[model samples]
Target: MIKKLLELSNLETTISLRQKELLELEEKIEEKKRLLKQLSRKVRKYEEYNVAEKEAAVTVAVEAEPDSEKKVGEIARTDLVRLLESGRVPQSVIESLKDKRYSKDTFDLNFPMLREVTDMGKVDELKKDQ
Candidate 1:
């Protein structure tokens, strides 16, 4: 009977050890789940922050320029004739000024005398008058 009691006690000790191991494993699993949840929350927050920053930058760029105007080219024959008849500019210069594709810099670079005849404001004034 004493031998039987000793055997039963050994069996109980083995079962107690197994139960402790199982409890430790369960605790480790719970800790991993908590850490995974925290990491997922951090990732989602960063994604939302990145999207908001990009949207704000785009909005700022669009709103920065409200009244910016583009410069358009204009050349009128009537203005060219008036400039020519005024005796301030030559006939050849007047003929060359008929084309609207040429800017003041381009015309002056091609024919220096054209620059002396019509002031830079002449083309702009003629466009406004028309």
Candidate 2:
């Protein structure tokens, strides 16, 4: 009976050791899962940050033109060239007409004209006429 008791005690000790090992393994797995979750969250935040930065860059690019009036003036200059090319106006007359119209304040003249032309609904009218 004493021998049987010793054997039973040894078996009980072995079972306890196995249970302790299992609990340790479970704790390790839980820690790993928590770490993975934290890493995933960080990755998601980085992705969102990148997306927002790209959107802001695109917005800035869309509105990057410094002076809208200057662009319009350049367009008008090109139109004048086209009109002269089409024989609507003679080349010899064009230079004299430009000198009279522009004078010393040539650069200043067009910005305000461009602004007024844009504000006065002239662009829509011109588009319709075309």
Candidate 3:
């Protein structure tokens, strides 16, 4: 019957649309998982350099590897990035850097900053689930 054929056509079309949507949702879930992993790594890095408040006034010993060549009195920008991300750096310290705020006395070191750059141009279409 023509009525029966129409019903079959409509049902197939609806199923195809839903299948496409399911694929898109799956892709988003995967993307979110990747982002979570990146954030967790950042958090772990933050925790590594984090200091407890009670230990604030305490002086800690510094031990550099005999073969290491890192400077004793300087941190690179990436190191600065860690400090900034740690959230424990006093606002005063951040403020004091003002003159060095992109200001001179500002010895340039590569600091890590928390920034996520999403390029929208590379988005891909999710293929429909079979």
Candidate 4:
């Protein structure tokens, strides 16, 4: 009877150790799953950026212009490029908009104050007004 009791106690200890190990392994698996989700989101963001770059390349080729003259849209983009350095906007959002061309007619309609100041050639006046 004494020998049987010792055997039973040893068996119980072995089972408890295995249970602890199993719990640890499950925790590790959950941590790995979280990491995988984060990595996947990053991959998707980069994929979208790649697609935008390809589209921009095609647009630049189609809208080639002489170096001496600048288009109205080009002028707006040049002025707006300051957003990239302003730190108020996200870098990713600014990068997407930096290469985009804005129509002067659209700008005038949407932002009349901006259009008026830009047209009047008063950079300081616009800044002071804003």
Candidate 5:
């Protein structure tokens, strides 16, 4: 009985020491995380300051120009440049447009009728077979 009691006491002591060490390790881990967060905050602050400095230097050298160079319909230039950038121009219409010698009126659209349809027909045919 005495030998068993002595073994249990030794085991209890070892367990208590291990638990104390584990608690100390957890506290150290939390402290390290706090230090890391502080360091990251400092790094972010310096990055923001560096960016602000560069922006200040760049803005000093930059000058504003008149915007009269841009056309009223900027999307036309965007779309045309996008199409040209893709390098897939293979249509006869585009080739004819590239000819550049045609009269300006050749591109004019002819329209005399304007109609708007808003009705959705039911599940029955409205027109008979011809």
Candidate 6:
């Protein structure tokens, strides 16, 4: 009887461990899905910008609605966040921006399309994810 009880307890423990691992795997899967969606959106934005490479030169055109009041040449902050998360921008560039002392000219020079970022909260979230 004691041996049977011990075996049952062992089985219960195994079940619990497996459940925990399953939950972890689910979370990882969800994260991957989110990343995939973000990448898809980035690709679409690139298409809208009309970025194309021809004859070893790149051309970019930003199209906006006639009634839109957005600045003539500026990329959205969320787009920048996605770009940073996508690993297209080198880790060194992100590291350099970590310091708040960087001048606007330097920032503009590095990220020409990004005129300004109002919601730094997303950047913080991106750092936390990394």
Question: How high is each candidate's TM-score?
Answer: 0.47, 0.48, 0.42, 0.48, 0.48, 0.39
**Between prediction 4 and prediction 6, which has the larger lDDT?**
4
For model 5, the stretches where C-alpha displacement exceeds 4 angstroms are: 63-130
Instruction: Encode model 3's per-residue lDDT on 1-130: one tens digit a residue.
Output: 9999999999999999999999999999999999999999999877654534213411211121324565634443444555566776555344544433332333342331122226645333211111
Ten-residue stretch with the least lDDT total in model 3: 57-66
Candidate 2 structure quality by residue, lDDT tens digits, 31-117: 999999999999999878766665554354335454545675475566444544566443333443345244235444432222114
User: Where does model 1 exceed 4 Å of error?
Assistant: 1-4, 71-130
* Model 2 stretches with alpha carbons more than 4 Å out: 66-130
Scored by Cα lDDT, where does model 5 land? 0.53
Candidate 3 overall Cα lDDT vs. reference? 0.52
* Clash tally, candidates in order: 0, 0, 10, 0, 0, 0
The Cα error of candidate 4 at residue 93, in Å, is: 20
Per-residue accuracy of model 1 over 1-130 as CA lDDT, tens digit each: 9999999999999999999999999999999999999999999998787666655543543344434352212222343334445675434344444544443454433322233326665765544422
Error of 2 at 81 (Å): 27
Return the clash pairs for model 6, or none: none
Q: Write the per-residue lDDT of candidate 6 for residues 1-130, one digit (tens) a residue.
A: 9999999999999999999999999999999999999999999987655433221121111221334455533444444555556665544345545544442344433333322347776765543312
Q: In candidate 6, how many Å is residue 7 off?
A: 0.4
In angstroms, the error of model 6 at 61 is 14
User: Which residue runs does candidate 4 get wrong by more than 4 Å?
Assistant: 65-130
Off by over 4 Å in 6: 51-130
Worst 10 residues of 6 by lDDT: 55-64
| TM-score of candidate 2 to 2 decimals | 0.48
Q: Candidate 1, 27: how far from true, in Å?
A: 1.1
| C-alpha lDDT of candidate 6 relative to the true structure | 0.54
